[model samples]
Structures are given as structure tokens and as C-alpha cells.
Target: MSFVIRNIDKVIVGDGKVLSNADIYVKDGKVSAIGAGLTVPENVEVRYGSGFCAMPGLWDTHCHVQSSGGIWGVDKDMLPEAKAIRAAAQAEPVVLSGTTTLADAGCDGNISFALRDTIAAGIVRGPRLLICGYMIRMTGGRAGKDTEGEVDGPDSARKATRKMIAKGVDFIKLGATGAVSSPGMKQWSPQLTLEEITAACEEAHKAGLKVHSHAYGDEGINLSIRGGADVVVHGITLNDENLQLMKDRSIQLLATLSTYKAKLPYLDKLPRWQAVKHIQVCELLEANFKRAVKAGIDVVAGTDSGMTFNYFGRSSRELDYMVEMGMTPAQAIKTATISAARSFGLDHETGSLAAGKAADILLVRGDPLADIGVLGKAGGVAQVFVAGRLVAAFDECGKEIG
Candidate 1:
């Protein structure tokens, strides 16, 4: 499992530095060297990198890996075997699209955990997965009481956090506010009380795990910040005070802008209530995201893929929306690379093209800095490698070749 990509035209270091005419050497599942004119190792495969731009593989921090149903939501009664099969199949396209790592925001049962383990065991070909077993929510809150995440009071929340930790979750997801995808849930109203949210955060932090709070409105955002949330997912309405607090606490924002934007094309097909909320959120997202950028908030790119029309394999489209909102192409790319890894405490292992880091890299055909949309365009991704192993390769027409 060793190879050298020789004579790359350009190399995006994934930390705002792009080197020209460089070579990347990967051995034993880690990057060994990244510079020009490196000595070739004996018996290692050498791949020509001419006309290719090598970069760190992308990351998507917010996704539902086990669910794929549209606006009506995933069928709760679906058989577990069927769910596992469908979920594994759905993840293949994501890695093929150049995303090397992704986080499952929430999932039912043990599907996501099973998927993550199987991928690690090489039972399946997919991106590196980080998952929260189930999102903690108030009774009658988002996703309803029938779900496993229903918790009320501080003690209940703490217990729920422990349960998820016992289940081997990577992080804890708290539903601080209602969501647009949930019918009858008001997006502006906070769902989990400050005490409840704080309890979950405290328990999770004690276990050395970060907490991602699903919040949109100002009230929910403030509650989450005060509750010690490490990251705010879909933080759409950040006021001046909340923005300042986030800056002071170094709280990162995972803006799932592509979630709502992806639904625009099928607005007519959605229920009126959901469609209206999507439209309103889209408008608010652009303005608020611009404000977040200006306020110097660390914004990470995440697509709520598997939600409605926000399909997998198009996760890079979130970076496109980020560039359109306010970021430069390079900045947007960093959001999905270095910034994302830092938010999730994976920077030391992956995220950038550097020696001693995992050899998770993507080879694209063109310069994404010149046109950010190239990431989302067909045939843009040339090859994808995870841990120095070639997982996927695409033809010129965006067809999977390996």
C-alpha cells in the first residue's frame, strides 16, 4: 500500500497554500513526503500526476448516513436489514465524489455505527465516518417521541448522553431547536431547555467528546453557546451578541446551506409548509452566513445530505454555496478541509496534505480555486484515495472506473 504521485501540476495543501510541480509520497497509509524531486522508494507504484491538482480529500460534517427518504422522512418502520443495505449503498457515491470523511449528524438504532465499523474493516468502500448514535431531543420535539432520542429534564438528558456514549458514538448531537424538516415544529422556538442542553454537553465533554447542537434561531443559538456546545449546526440566525460570544468561545458553525438550497428545484413538489420554510431559510442563510464570515466566525462546510433533496455525492456543493455566500474559493475549500478537521479534532490525523497525516487525498482535473463550481461539476473528480489505498477513480464523464 505505497505509491508516489509524481510531478503534480499543482498541490492544494488544504491550508491556503498551493504548491506547483510537487510530488506526494504515501507509504503505509500515511503521507511520507510532499515536495518536488523526492527519491523513489524500491518496488513502490508510481502514478503520473500530470495535469492533476492534488488536494486533501473533502469533509462533510453534517449528514444522516442511515436515512435517505425525502420530505416525508425515513420510514421508521423500515426493516433494519433493509436500512443497513440501503445506507451502505448510499455512502459509496459520497467517497467517489472526493469526500474522504463525513459525520453522521444523527441516525436511528445502530445502523450508522455498523456502517462506520464495516467501512473500517474494509467490508465496504466508503468515506471515513464519524457518527452520533441518535440526536437528543425533548419529548414531542423534533423527530417526535417515538424516536430513541426523546429526553426531557436535565437528568434524562444526562442519561441519554451516557447511553449514546455506551453505544460508541463519536460525538453528541443535541436538538437545541426545532427543524424545518419536522412537521409542526416551529423553527424559531427552542426545544431543549438550557439545563437539558448543558447536562448533555457536560456529560459528553467529560467523556472527551464534542457536542454539536442543531440550532437555527437566535434564542436557540444563545442557549447552545451557553450550554457549551462545541459546534452549532445550521446556525442561521446569529445576532451581534451571539456572534461575539461564539468568537470568544471559539465555537465553530457548521452551516448546512446546501440543505435548503437543494430543495429549491423541487419546491412545487414539497408540502406548502415545508417549502415555505425552506425558501425563507434560504434567504436568511445567505445574509446571516455573510455576517458570520465578516464577524470572523469559523464556518465549516456541511451538507445535510440524506435530507430531502440534499443527496449524497454532491456534498461539495456546500462549498460552492459557501463561496457564493461570502468566502473566496480557497477559503471555502479550507472550510471543508482544515477547518472541518479542526472543529472535529481530526486535524492531527487528516484534513491536510502533510507528512505524518493520513493519506486521504483527492485528485481533480482542474483548478478549483479558479472556479469553485468545479468541485460540484461532472467529471471534476479524477481519483480518490483513503489511507493510501485507491478507493475510487472516475472517468472523464464522471463515471466510476474503480
Candidate 2:
């Protein structure tokens, strides 16, 4: 298939630069040529830009496309079969929301990857899936209890990682700290020892897989870096030394700020019965996000979806949080579009709108660069495309079909 997306008022080209009156030629699921006023062949499809702004499709470096019913700070029992159904349910709206590529954060293991494969085959429309089959964690660690996978020592961690690799996973995830959802665990507490983390990272690296770590606080962050973690999923609170270390190491951070803000509404009018532990998470996020950016660490975008009101199909709220943290609109967009793909090791395939890259792009009615809030409004994104094919088109009601 070939098409000329012509007369774009402004095109966000590669490297975060915008071009005026540009046209994009797409052929065979990749951008063929990007230029201005290019004449087109008679047989080629001509797609009118319609005064909308064109930019690279957004990417979510971390999300959970699983089924767990609960409000933020609340937990509910979930069955594996039901979780698979819910994962498929969430994926549909995500593709409509303009996220073309998503890194599912360890929602399945070797046993559950069969369900993931079914979802990939066409159960619903969503971003291309790059899954971390099952997260490796010390026994009783964060994701371990929730997802039912755990390992204590080097040998066990290596064995578990090899099993995931054998299942053909794209990457690996490790929990270096106790998570907020886990009972009696502080947000900053380190769960996995450095030795365990190193074992998992080494095995995953040897298998040519990227390693992402869930971490917060000083000890957890340090362990992640020392373990050679490629992506730091969430570092909600960090010290000066940790910031410097991440910057020096070029470790990418996926600051899923919305996951914290989603709890604000619950706290504003909290009853005495409500738990106050979640307050710690909010406090740490405010402190760490500003510090990480000041230290010049590359902070990418992420949303810990499936966590209390953090919906799978909605990610624009994350960009809003980035702006609230003092990032300029362009920088916030970069976090989700280009920087995110780089963090997930998919920059060669997709990210920016450039020749020879996947034609994953979005058409928004207004300039998202002028107002980051434009992204939060569903109406702003008029059309979404994946691999050079139109997948979702919205009318007045945001009634989109893929």
C-alpha cells in the first residue's frame, strides 16, 4: 500500500524538529520519503492533512494489560482466564488513543504467553506487544506475589530467566523493590538483593534481551544500576548520588507520575477507614521526578496501567503529569514518542517520523506543542495510524473503530 499524506501544516520530523507544509510518502508500512510539495503518482492514495498536526505515534514503555479489578489503593481477586479477557478488553481503546507500540510490563509468564499470543493474533487492536514473559523477583518480592513468579538465589533466577527466554520474550523485568500494592511494604524498601538482580540481568543479557527493573528509593535504585538494568521502571525517590549514577550510566527512567496522581481524588475526602500508606507514594513522586530531571537523566514516559483507575487505553494523562512536573510541551511529547522507544530498544523500528521507520503516526487537530493539555482531550487526536495503515478515526463523539 502507498499513500501521500499531503499538505501537512506542520510535521514533527525526526529529532524533534517540525517542518512546514510537508508531505509524507508511505509505502509497504514504512515512511518512504518526507519532503515538501512533492508531486504524487496518479494511482497513489492522497490523504489530506486537514489542517491537523502530524507527529510520530506515541509509545508507552511500561503498562500492564492484565485484568485486576479494583480502584487505586484497592485490591481484588483475579482469575488467570479472566485476566486474559480483561487484557484484551483494555487493548482496544489503547490503539484508539494513539499509542502504537506498548511494552507490557510482565503481565504473563511462559504459561500465560499462550494467551498473549492469542491477543497478538487479532483478539483486539493495540500497540505491537513486546512482552516480558514473567518478571523475576526474589521470593515474596513485589511483582512476585501479584503475578505468581518468584526466585531467591542466582541459580533459580537464571533458570527462571532462561524459561522466559525460551518462551521467546522480547525483554525481562525484575523487581528490585517492594511495590506499593504489596502489603506492609514501604515504597522505598529494597526487595531483591544485588546478587539476585545481577543473576537475572546477566542471564537476560546473555540471551540478548533488554532488562527493566522496578525500583524506588536509594538502595533499590543502586541495585538496579549495579545489576546492569537497561530501564528503570519507576524511581519515585532518589538521592543526589543516585541521580548522578543514573545520568553517568545513561539508564532511562520511566516516571509513571499519573499512577500517583490518580490517588489524589481518593485522598482529598478520605474517610477514617481509608489507608494512608498511599500518601507516601505521592510524596516520593513529587520529590523524585523534579530531582531526576534536574540531574539530566533521560526520563521516559510510562503508565502503570491496571492499577486503580489507571486504564490501559488511556495514556495522555501521563503527558499531563510530565508538564505539571515542569517539562516543556515538546520535551513531554519526546518522552512518549522518541525517548520511550529508545528506552525499550525499539528506536530502529519506530519512534519518530522518519524515512525507513515504521509509519506509526497521529493526526491531532491542534498543536500539542502549544498546550500539552491538548493531548489529554480525546478529541484532539483526530486519527491514529499504525504501520502506515489507518486504524482509528474519531468523529464528534470520539467514536473510533480500528
Candidate 3:
């Protein structure tokens, strides 16, 4: 036995099914066995606990960890090297928050890639990252200044997609529409044309990677799905057509409400006009969020954790927002677990507590199925394990912890 977590009160799979009184056995770095009785090797460590619930570790499908930390205290204007240090420090907080896997929605190539490699080598503590080095955008697309790759025509879009593939990106990010945070642009308006979007998607898919579109509104979302994009980053203003498109293509929508959730605190710092516009667009988004959730589509959750006041370790809040939008605790958790894993091509390695999957597990003090909000509280999570190794731990009394 490489490690063993025995005497667990219950084991919850990513899909919300619970296994009672189970012992999860691990060998090397994967779950080797899970049953009622399991014996551990004498030399291997054992973490036995009762009155706790274990499940697959959480996955945040949309995030920008480096840029989020850069805005908080650390100067975003600093050199790349200094910014990297700040970004690396942000990863531990996310891991402690119970997220074992992360997808950087979009970020700088230098910082996010370095963080991804560093985490992979075990040089630092962070989630297994599915990264897009930068977002490919049109000339007047959302996040133009911060976006890494920009193109003008079908040919250019294809080239940009290929370039990111050369850069070793796990997925491609596309700015399919305008954004609320961007000035002179409406959040529900399309930015890139059908030809341009299709070119990028075709190239990305050819290379065996998924394309996540920063899209909103029905038409914009429909174009992305029809163009062959695999995921929509923010389709909060979507309609019935978008739902049909998602179902038809087997695509997923990655909700990023956590960005709007931060607007009030950060609005005072923005220009009054821009701030008001930001609120207006999100009001429309919040209204349609429930409609989309109730449509019975494949939905995943993320914090988009890089804007002002939207820091790391807050991805769990997205789940709460999902529950508020009509999903049950189990369904909301599924969005961040197996659903998210399947969306991003990580289900085989993780997203469930089954044999042959990576031992990415979390032990919580209370039953999330009963009180989902407990998952957002710091003390609710008792332990976090990644690849059969313990990464975080807290005691039941909430005093003694590692």
C-alpha cells in the first residue's frame, strides 16, 4: 500500500451516489481498491476518519489564477519574473480550498505555462492545470489588451490556433463575443464572425484540443456551437436556441458568475459609466442563468478568478450560485466534478473515486448533500489528497490541523 484512507463514513462519487462505510485503497498514485474491507501495508501511512464524507476533488473549469493574484497587492505592472512569483503563491490557496484541478480560462503565456509546469514537476503545490496559454481574439474582441493572441480573418485565426498548439496548450480560448467589463462593447453582441470562429475551431480540433469560447447571448453561443467549439465560457444570456445547440453538439457551458459576484466591491474604483454598464449586463445574465440551468444541458462552474476582488480559493462560491440557480447540491457538485472533468477531457485520470483513477480526493466534515453551503466554508473541508498524497488536512474540532 502506498497510502490508505480507511474507516470513512461515506464515499460520494462525482455523480452524487454515496457508498457507505468504504475503505479506499491506493497504490502508487492511483485508487487501487475501494470496498468494505481493506488492509493497509504496515509501512504505508493510513488516514482513518469517521463522520466524514469523501468525494472526488473539485475542478474549477474557468480561472485565471496568475492574473487574479497579480491584481491583489502585487503590482500587475511588475515585470514578468516578479509577477510569476506572485502567481505561484496563489496556487496554494486554491488547493487548500479543495480544488484539485484547474483550467485557466485565459491568461499570459509566460506566467500560466510556468505555473503549470512547476506544479506538474511537484516543485510547488497547485492543481493539475488544463491551460490555454492565451485567448485568441478578434481586433475588437473582449479583453483585447490582455489577450495573448489576436487575429483578423479566417486565415489569421487558424494560424493563431496553431500557434497556441505549438505553445503546448491543453485547450484553445476564443473570444466569441463582447464582454461586460470591456468598454464600448455590449456583453451579448457577437465579435468574431462565423468564418473566423469556425477556422479556429477546426484547427484546434484537428490538433486534438477543445476550444472554449468566451460567449454570451443566443446568437453568439449558437455560432460557437455550430462552429465546432467544444465549450462556451459564459453563456449567461443564452436562449432556447443555444440550449438546442449545446444538446445537438454535445457541448458544455462553463458558467463564470463569480466574476459578476465581485462587481460591487470593485465598481467604486472603475469609471462611473463603465461600472453602471457592468451592472446592467450582469442583471440580464443573472436572469437568464436559471433558464439555462433548467434547460437540462451540460453545465460546468468556475470563478473566472482573476478580476478585481475575485481572488483564488473562491471557486466554491460558484457552486453556491449554481444551487441558487435551481441545481441541487448534488447536481451543482457534479458540475465541478465529473461533469467538468468530462467537459475538459480529464475524466479518465480523475473526477471520480473509482479504481484506476487518480487519487484526487477530498474529505469534508459534513454531508454536502444536506447543506451545500458548508462546502464554501473553510472549516468544512477536512483533508485533501492529490495522486494518493496528502496535500492539506484539518481536524474535526477545527483546532488541530496541518
Number of the top candidate by lDDT? 1
Better candidate number, 2 or 3, judged by lDDT: 3
Clashing pairs in 3: none
Q: Where is model 1 more than 4 Å wrong at Cα?
A: 74-76
Total backbone collisions for each predicted model:
0, 1, 0
Count of clashes in candidate 1: 0
Query: Against the unseen true structure, what C-alpha lDDT does each candidate score?
Result: 0.89, 0.78, 0.81
Over 204-278, each residue of candidate 3 has an lDDT whose tens digit, in order, gives 888878889998777888888888889888886677777877877778888787877766667787656657766
Question: What TM-score against the true fold does each predicted structure earn?
Answer: 0.96, 0.93, 0.93
Q: Order the numbered candidates by TM-score, best leading.
A: 1, 3, 2
- Residue-by-residue lDDT tens digits, candidate 2, 76-115: 4556667777677777677788888777777653323654
Which parts of model 3 have CA positions greater than 4 angstroms off? Answer: 39-44, 69-76, 143-148, 397-400
lDDT tens digits by residue: candidate 1, 1-402: 788999999999987788999999999999999999899768989998999899999999999877784666446677877888888998888898889999999887788999999999999889999999989999888753256888989999999999999988989999999899888877878999999999999999999889999998999999999999999999988999999999999999999988888898999988888898888798788889999999999889899998887788778999888887778999999999998998777888899999999999999999998988877777898999998989988888888785
Best by TM-score: 1
